[model samples]
Target: MAQGQSDPSCRRSPPPGGRSLRQRYSGDHLQRILLVRGLLKLLLVVAVLAGATAAGWQPATAWWAARNRPKFDTLAAEQGDVIEVINSTGTIEPVQSVQVGAFVSGPIVGLHADFNGEVKEGDLLAEIDPRTYRAVVARDKAALAARRAELERGAARLQQARREEDRSNALAERNVASISESDLDQAHFTRVGMEAEIVMAEAAIEQAEANLDTSEANLGYTKILAPVAGIIIDRKVELGQTLAAQFQTPELFVIAPDMRREMRIFASVDEADIGQIRLAQESGKSVQFSVDAYPGEVFEGKIAQIRLASTTTQNVVTYPVVLSTPNPELKLLPGMTAEISFQVDRRDGVIKVPNAALRFYPVRDHVREADRVILDGTALEADDQARGESPSASAKAEAEGERKRRHVWVVEADGLLRGIPVTSGIGDHRATEIVSGDVEPGQRLVVGVAPKDD
Candidate 1:
């Protein structure tokens, strides 16, 4: 046999299943190629799905946006009262108050007045210990009596000296008396000395009388009296309480004269509001106020005084504005807090705009390009910085001249925003007075974008 040819017996035969080993291996390799093709098909399907999803996203978002378009918040311009006011909290006090105190140092022996008690002028409010004062008065009286007795004795002595001097003169004239010339001179000197002593005694009596009067006055002071007819709002002294008035008068009571008739609210108004307060006073506008004690009860007052003195606290200056209100009911008490409103100006049936409308800022895209210049304050700043420019001096001057001119937004029928210039007057927290503007009553003014709901 040649090397290239094999014997018939050496060649292998097919298996009983009629499949050779080469054929079986060929089948397995074909199955693997088919499985690889199936995996490629799966990957292609996944890629197609991803592409489809990406392509549909924008349309889905558009449909949702069309369905839930942004609605704007709006307010209507109308005719109403535009009231400008300055509000503040103030402490209520009596229009006039008197402080009663002890002039003499002594223990409080009796209390004749009570807190919140009504009193008249000269009514005894309290009493100090009178025993010591009475003793002083008695001593002063005795001293005065002694001075009078001394004065009487001195007068009698002066009369006797005068008579002695007369006797000496008679003896000298008759030239038959035992008295010598030196004795006559001594008598005259004694009479003169007696007269001087009598004068001194009279002065001592007057001094003693003054001392007695002072003692009596002090005794009277022991009984504390109300200086004016009023209600006792406070009492500082209790029975048996000692008061030391050596340095200063010890405050014993506080009386408010005719507090029921009128109560004053000392409101600290900002200096910025002082001018308006003066204007309100000149205009005869009544101030509206209420107290915590009567939350629902409103009280009316007039500007009584606007003090020139200003109080400074933390770089803020405030002037004291005194508001006088009639409190015939006596419901407003001292130290009660009052919420007051000083109406600076009031205009009725005037075109007014909502404050929100004035403060609203519109989206840049929502506004027209020409009106986008006044879209929002922050945007305006950014726009200015980008342009490297600022408002011109003439523009600023024009804006200042147009004191009430401001820019506001309105929605056209096409659902886009357009800014229109408006002239405003006095305003309050809720609305501003429209002096002149293209806007009319009942016209809807865009405030802001309404919130989207889920």
Candidate 2:
């Protein structure tokens, strides 16, 4: 080769120690280029997948939320009668009950009355053994007779002393007896000893007579006479039962007086509900009750009295209320349980709404504080006057007297809901009377919204 020129094969490629660019890359260097190309392809695939996921995520989320959204429940305001009531439980009892018991202690020998036997006043119910009492009477009688005989003997002795004194005085006047003899006879007649003996004997006779009377009276008690007319519901003693009235009188029978007459019910009223109860006889309101035995039948009664005494159980205070009802057929029995209800107040033809509507609250996000309507009694009264419905003094007082502020939700022409402040009266728990409010009948109100699925 020349100094500045090379062979053609060498010039067409590279020098002997170097390589051409295509040949250099065609060796182990080609592996590095292939790796870079694979990396770029992987990056393009990742970018496509991320773009597709981003494009589809929003629609799926929206579909899930729309499928699970809760719906609202609403109720219509209505016109009806709303009656407030107080409920209680009571025990049936006779108007008059008498406990027949043994006044004296003895073995019962006979029974004239039994369970469910009707009897009259002064009728014999049972008989105690009267042998011992009869013996007592006999002994007292003998003592009385002896005392009477002793009194007679004392009188006879006094008579004899008087006769002897008279004879001695006559003999002394005829000079046939000594003055000392006459004086001794006179002393025997005038002495207080015979008079005193006679008086003591009479007193003894009187005491014996009184003791006999007492024994007889005690014997009469053994007959176990009924004090009042009634039915014998309980018999505590059988024949040959011994009653020992040591500390307290032994009960023999329980008498329910006059089952054909009226009956009584003793009811326990809770302190929270006691203010609503009054004597039905005074208020002319009837009380209705039902028994477990007669589930479908309702009996009527009148309040007799409200007990002032209170009883406490488990920190809950209650008072006893008495009610009376006629039992001409004698169907109501003693000790029967009665479910009682008393009418506290009543309002007719009033605009009313379901209690659920008054108790509903919208979700916090759905309501704004400014949209809430809260009206006091004065404001409600002014609204009523503006509407040409003038309220009475008593009605205004009743509204002001209430301590609770009731509210109900009413749906507006818009899709949103707003609260309406109201004065309510005569609630039956299922429905309530709307005394004064901006709401009207046929208005749709929200009762409750369906709970969220989550």
Model 2 C-alpha RMSD vs. true structure (Å) is: 10.7
Write the residue-wise lDDT of candidate 1 on 140-259 in tens digits: 999999999999999999999999999889988878557787999899999999999999999999999999999999999999999999999998888999989898889999999998
* Tens digit per residue, CA lDDT, model 2, 1-454: 6798867875555656687566666667888888999999999999999999899989988887666654568889999898888888999999888999888889999999999999999999899999999999999999999999999999998787777667667767878546676576566656457788899999999999999999999899899998999888898999999989777899999998977778999999998777778534467788999998889899999888899999999999999999999988878999999999898788899999988987886764454455533434446757777898766899878756663467787655444567787887778869898889888899887898767665
Off by over 4 Å in 2: 1-70, 165-177, 181-191, 279-281, 368-404, 412-414, 451-454
**Candidate 1 residue runs with Cα over 4 Å from true position:** 1-65, 176-179, 376-403
What lDDT does candidate 1 reach at residue 306?
Answer: 95
Candidate 2 residue pairs in backbone clash: none
Q: Model 1 compared with the native: what TM-score? A: 0.81
**Top lDDT model:** 1
The 10-residue segment of model 1 with minimum total lDDT is: 373-382
The C-alpha lDDT values of all candidates are 0.89, 0.83
